[model samples]
Target: MTACGYRVGGQGASLPTEIKVIAVPAFENRTPWMRLEQRLTAAVMQEFIHRSRYRVVGKEQDADAVLRGAVTSATTTPVIFAPETGRASAVQVAVRVSVELRDRRTRATLYANRDFVFREQYEISSDLDSFFEERDPALDRLARDFAASLVSAVLENF
Candidate 1:
């Protein structure tokens, strides 16, 4: 009972407490990026492990629910324009993801949302080679932060 004079386990009650395991499937990527799926999947797994009360399982059969996600967009655009040749002075990388939560046993959707965007800006470098190399580290950081935010939002009932 939750102070409402209703049994917690009966109909019209609050959500059940038995759902504690989650399976994160490989995210489908609609973008041209070849490895975004792997990156996003890894980040989501890491976030769930770090901050959530639920346990993450690799197999859907082992979990109470499964979380399906898709990377809808990944793009890089010039943020600043160079005055000399009208070239990009800096670049911004953005990623958009859509997520769905479903019960594995009942096959019922619990939640779904889209257009979760995460972006990061990087300074332009004199050499293109160094720019690409440095981009990985920044992207990794951004992915981790984005995953954390997503997980927090889901768990907090947002």
Candidate 2:
């Protein structure tokens, strides 16, 4: 009988075996939104710490590998509107990023994506009292999601 080479499931750990420490710095923000980089960078660091086997550092000088990124663009557009008031009831936020993972010792890029785009939709509460409270949390959720996807892509080397 001929044997097929198909594997069972995901074979993780595509990074080099020598890479044990990773540095993740605050990504540069080119968008109009304030503190977007901070939130996204923090989320990525947290994801690596929680999900990966590598030790994460703040400075690139102290790590075996570096993950760098930039927030290239951000836009908010109304997706849903209130029928009675003819005003926006929900908004879709789209963020574009450029990310790269490089090996410090080898001076080679392990992974790079120049145009990673992520979008999330959030409901704009019609109640004025709770309106402002929803913005930060929604952004936080989006950042977390982006972080997870980025880390997965890097680890899987896709």
Candidate 3:
């Protein structure tokens, strides 16, 4: 038997059945950060393609299952202060993601988890370039890591 307990179509050879296709919906961002929805959606889609057995589908209607996620919290805190200027030298940013997997046809949840936190530190730049430049990159990376972990957890349980 394969990992997923299915045999190959013709050969009686055991092979894991592919998840094949999934849909990721735009995540709801409760934080003040506006672009998190788009960034997280993209990250989850990429994770499905990269780390999982599933192929990400462009449309929800086309998918066998749907993976939905939300950004429950995104926060940044000054961790280190420069003595000379009393300015923040380093900041720790954390992103919390909640995800659920559901069968598209039955609308039944297969797996669900909440408050998966991913954190990263960023150095304070001397000059302010843009808010997004400072925040979005780290947030995106956190989201991507969270997605990867989530996928692994779900697959392992199966």
TM-score of each: 0.79, 0.90, 0.74
Tens-digit lDDT track for model 3 on 5-60? 65433221211343357888788888888888787788777876776556788678
Which stretches of model 3 miss by more than 4 angstroms?
Answer: 1-18, 129-133
- The residue pairs found clashing in candidate 2 are none
Q: 1-158, model 1: which lDDT tens digit per residue?
A: 44665442212122246678889988998999877788778898888887766788777888998888899998989999878878787888888999987887788777677878888786776566787787677677767877886776666546
TM-score of 2: 0.90
User: How do these models rank on TM-score, best leading?
Assistant: 2, 1, 3
Best by TM-score: 2
Highest lDDT: which candidate?
Answer: 2
Per-candidate Cα lDDT values, in order, are 0.77, 0.90, 0.71
Tens-place lDDT per residue, model 2, 20-42, is: 99999889999989999999999
The number of clashing residue pairs in each candidate reads 0, 0, 0
How high a TM-score does candidate 1 get?
0.79
As a whole number from 0 to 100, the lDDT of residue 62 in candidate 2 is 95
Ten residues in sequence with the least summed lDDT for candidate 1? 7-16
